[model samples]
Target: MSTKIKANTDAFIKARVVKGYSQRELARHSGLSHAYVSLLERAIKSVGPSTAKKLSDLLDKELEELFRIEMQPRP
Candidate 1:
């Protein structure tokens, strides 16, 4: 089963910004859909390991560094 991952929105955004990748650009680099990237950025969706790995590799970060343990409670 694929479990949802808890991510820090600020960190995520910062990484993207530091890399100079727009959502669409990150989507291309990470092999994820642009809409999905937007959803992730908005915290509307959670990421699984596969997706996280792709993004991590693209960002050149460790897998664990891409996310946090405490997730935002659903609204």
Candidate 2:
């Protein structure tokens, strides 16, 4: 939809695949809902910092490594 929701979708999918996890499995591990994980994979929802941290901890990835969106520059 809106520009294909580009925030490391590919990497997230890859990580999930490498870990042999289904969307439901990842959601369970991350304390998120299965529908929410599906939305993220389909690029229908953006991952916020808290969610990212949860995924990072569950996936054993650094928060920065999970998202590639450029951060706003400090003023």
Best by TM-score: 1
Q: Write the per-residue lDDT of candidate 2 for residues 1-75, one digit (tens) a residue.
A: 121122477878888888889999998888889999988877677777677777877777776666655445454
Error of 2 at 13 (Å): 0.5
My TM-score estimates for the predictions, one after another, are: 0.77, 0.73
Question: How far is 12's C-alpha from truth in model 2 (Å)?
Answer: 0.2
Off by over 4 Å in 1: 69-75
Q: Encode model 1's per-residue lDDT on 1-75: one tens digit a residue.
A: 334775567778888889899999998887889999888877778888788888877877776776754445565
Task: List clash counts for every candidate, in order.
Answer: 0, 0
- lDDT (Cα atoms) of all candidates against the true structure: 0.78, 0.74
In model 2, what lDDT does residue 27 have?
87
The TM-score of predicted model 2 comes to 0.73
